[model samples]
Target: MGILDAKALRDDIVARLLTDEVDLETSAYLDRILELAEMEEAEHQFLNDPFDRSVALVLQLFQDKDLDPWAVDLSAFLEMFSTRIEDTEDIDLPTCGRLIRMAWQVLRGQAETLIERQNHEDEVDEPWIYDGGWESDFDDNDYNFSVGIITGTHKERLPDMFSGRIQREEGRPVTLGELLMGLKAASRISEEQNLRLKIAEKRRASLEMARERFSGSLHVEDLEGDIRRTWEAMRMRANPEDQTCTLSAISEELADRSMESGTIREEANAEAQVAAMVATLFLVNRGYASIEQKDAIDGSVILTDLHPDESDFEELSLRLHPPPEIEEAV
Candidate 1:
């Protein structure tokens, strides 16, 4: 295809991707596979031998809903299989067994790695927990001592009473000091007001840190919402009829054009939008939603009311867009 044709192809693909009808990342993987086929002379060979089932099989396999084409780990696949294939040409039993063993090892390893990578990525992408207070190293004894001092407890009588209780329970002689320490260790303040105050303080600190990081301009939630809205809009616009195009295909095309024009800001924005759309689509498909009901809703349904939690919003945004940069306070 000419440069113009490639550009056109990219536009069509992007249109499909933005419509939410096609899997963008999967489309990108298929495009890569096609490109590799072209480079390896397989494209022309498949054309000449149109009846070649392998070509169709490969393409169909890439498009399979159950298969994760992006997580194929092609480099690892090649590394494992290429050497084994090179060493054997016979259709004999021993050679076949070795190839099977190597293939199994490669597949098992790739599957394990893919799962691990996905889990790690998910953990990294999740929003940080804001418990509203620092996790303390102070023990119960210290806490009790602080509480006793604040409450004005008679230190002497309290210890004697605690020691008597301990002696009864343990069937042994216990000192007043030791009993006091034990009581202190066992005691915990169960005041709801105090806990709430600590949480409020922590939340204030978190909000301040976030504001400083965003230069008091954008809330993390707002930036995240913008990306998600853009993505959802794009998905709603996608056409399900286009089988060959995807969001990733469009992204790569946009990225190329943006690079050519030196429009870094535009490119970054485009990347973020695409990532958000792709991520949202993937999550929705995978049954990760506030409401797990998947009805055949019209494309025109407004996504504004779909109140996804912050973590989900962030995941959707990061998937479709460039990762947000945490700016250092000046």
Candidate 2:
């Protein structure tokens, strides 16, 4: 269809929905358009991008009633959002993040509203019973689901459980935040005042450091550039016979740089080392450096300032195992 024909159809549909009661033909017209859009290319395109089309469909279906938490079928709405798009060609991280954030806000608002309503209802003379409408088909293991239902605190997990249906047989792994929420719900643990104070203290220190870094007197170093510079320096410092440095050596160099330069305290050596390793991995990904496990030494990977050759283009896993202290603590 041409642009004029498309506009006429849209206008007619909107008019029918607004004025008179629409019939099945209206729905059939839309369905037919969607079918034709898939099967044939048109001169005028409404939504050529799959991502745009999917998002438009979501808004068309849910923008009105679904925005009202009370009017929405929470399970179905969340299920639709949680499902992976069959066509992911044009979807980017920012788009995904925004969409996920919107869904999260809606879910959070719904939870708060329901909780407040339940609290108000509890104050009434009549007692209210809850139907397990939010609960999914998963069989409760021991006291997990029962206690959560009784306490009403874990209503947030309803979405997680519902979305977890496909992975039901594999066991839905509880995240750290979910586990913490569960512990708090069961009265096993509570946030201490000292913990909050400590967090505030850390934030204050970070803010001060941020101010110092951004001030005109001091310069904020580019971490990736600094890493590359340090790698080049490492090559220069190495023997002419062996110009390469091990990944562990590079990590130690970064840790020392942070400590000696007073950018970070000596107490954070382990964290600095881990951060350095991660940064170097990013560098490797961007082709700034090449990494390979040394056959001569067990569990040792070497890094070089040389750009990766065509032979190094293939994908491979390079494991960065935890330090002995970290392993022991775990």
Best by TM-score: 2
Using all chains and alpha carbons, the TM-scores for the candidates as numbered come to: 0.18, 0.25
Whole-structure CA lDDT of model 2: 0.44
| lDDT by residue for model 1 (1-330), tens | 321132222323222212224454445444643454454343223332221222222333334445444333333333323333334332122232333333334344434544555454344322234353222356889698778867878465564554463334335677657856655654433344456556656655654553353342221334334434444443444344431223333344435544666656543444433344344444444343211212322111212223233435466445655668999999
Who wins the lDDT comparison? Answer: 2
- In terms of lDDT, the poorest run of 10 residues in model 2 is 310-319
TM-score of 1: 0.18
Error of 2 at 326 (Å): 50
Residue pairs in candidate 2 whose N, alpha carbon or C atoms collide under 3 angstroms: none
lDDT of 2 by residue, 237-317 (tens): 444555567654554566676677665543234434434455566766765667676443233566676532222222311
lDDT of 2 at 254: 60
